[model samples]
Target: MTPFFASAASFVDPLDEVSAQMHDVTSKPLRDIVVAGERLVAVGDNGLIIYSDDHGQTWLQAAVPVSTDLNAVFFSDPLKGWAVGHGAAILHSTDGGKSWVRQLDGRTLEALFVDYFEHRSGLDTERAQSYLSALLSMTRPGPGQFFMGVWFDKAGTNGYAVGPFGLILGTQDGGKTWQPGNTSIDNDDLLHLTGVRQIEGALYITGERGRVWHLDQSSKRFVMGEVGYDGTLFGITGRDSTLLAYGLRGHVFRSIDAGRSWASVSNDFAAGITAGTAVDGSGLVLVSQAAQVAISRDEGTTFELLDVPRPTLYTGVVSMTGGQLAMVGLNGVTTLQIQ
Candidate 1:
């Protein structure tokens, strides 16, 4: 969810009541979409989570407990999933995408960070104080906090959610508990962490100023991998050994050796790339905020622009069943077929 200004003393319940009745939200703003088993789950503003089982021809609303806008969602499996968004809220669901329960929120998040920094080990007094101060300023018990991206491992045992000002939270036991993960990363500037993905055998995070980080196995921490452009990177996706990081002003870069190096890839549009995903057998797809679509048939080596039926600000894209694509954004969900 986007930021909303409010008094520091003002308090908004993160678990605000949401309606249970179903409504036609197909044309509402949607931020992210994912495939959970055979169901297509899309989330957006007003705590909306809509699912479709028939290739996005029709949609059904899910039961969400909070009214805050949900920015990102991920399913460890068809049966277990989580959604995070404004007010620093984390919602969990066990039955596909039918219903969700509040797991954590801004109030709890503030406490968690304060405790972590106050009791953290191996930090110099000045550095620990600096970290604690930053966390206190960022997690100020309010509703403006936002989570931009989320990803889970194959076995659903580990997961991560990242967002504004280098906010990173990790869960080792299926989101039952979350711990601050920013201490391990090398984000001194505290830039906004936009996306997280587990590709190949490691986890990669993209953030502001073209910063990319990979989880170091030996150190058990996230280390800076490489920098390609000076602009912000919105998202990253990979297929096999090839990876793509895309962001501000149509910038896109590819790395084949797991973030060791990168090469700039030419893009047709000047608008920023907001989302990307790997197709099962067709290659990679990247969508921009200008509603432009690009297809890379050679594992992101090269891309060609594709025509969009209805141009709108696209926030997320996912490859669907039968070589189809489902996109969600300001104008809601749209399905595209590629040959």
Candidate 2:
């Protein structure tokens, strides 16, 4: 038997490849979907971004500068948006997801961490050393880093993205530059931050081991909040003061006082919930990894599971025109007309 060895020359960064080539990806796996004004944009593996102006009726692939597997996409406004994915990649699009340009990647992220930690070492040697060690472990090369969630403030001025090993980044000047936000949060164990959402003018983040953090404007830091469940939370969703955090094994908790307290929402499905979205008027929906959809009409007080047409592992969900719902997951994009 002959053994083969891996070499640096054989490795290629996904960001170096262009994603302009297109095929029929309607049946392909898509991770997330968002509505940008009247158009709907969906992103998934291999840096694929497809937009549909006529509601999921037709799709056109966007010009993506990278071929990495994008995990999340967010549009602060109709024309400005960002996408984050594997390799700690961040891509920006100015024209409503028609095209994308790389803003940050694992290499840039590594440099940023090194520079930030080196500067921080002077102020707090012990803390900086610990953080520097963690950062160094992730920067060992390849596509080991992943950004799971991305969100922008309503005004489109401030933006944030989160990922594994407590990686968080903030950008005040849109996507022009990014800064480390790990110091702002109290993540002692370096848990993976899987999801982030802005609720009631405040930002909240969910992560592994039942960790939930709320951004305190006065202190300019993310303060940890109490939650009963200890499973990994994949996504957070709600409107106004009501919020829902869902994750492994279909576990969900509802927060009425902006995450100060959480109460369990009754769920029957056993599949892990991957994403959720709030309806326009007064409702919310959560999607599971097994393609199960749960609808809560009473602001997450209760839920009713709906049978999907196909059983594909879903990753994200979004409300669309006329009370419709569009889900993205293992099978590209699917539309749901809720009655």
- Please report, as a residue range, the 10-residue window in candidate 2 with the lowest summed lDDT: 1-10
Report per-prediction Cα RMSD to one decimal: 4.0, 2.5
User: What are the per-residue Cα lDDT tens digits for candidate 2 across 1-339?
Assistant: 433445556666677988757678777789999999999999999989999998888899999999999999999889999999998899999999999999888877777777777784354878887877875675342257889999998677788999988888888888788877878889867788998887667788999988789989899899998579878988788887788988999899988888899998888767999999988874899999877998988889888988777668999888987888889889788888887
Highest-TM-score candidate: 2
Task: In candidate 1, list every pair of residues with a backbone clash.
Answer: none
Judged by whole-model lDDT over C-alpha atoms, candidate 1 comes out at: 0.86
Cα displacement (angstroms), candidate 2, residue 181, comes to 1.1
Residue 122, model 2: lDDT of: 57
* Backbone clash count, each prediction separately: 0, 0
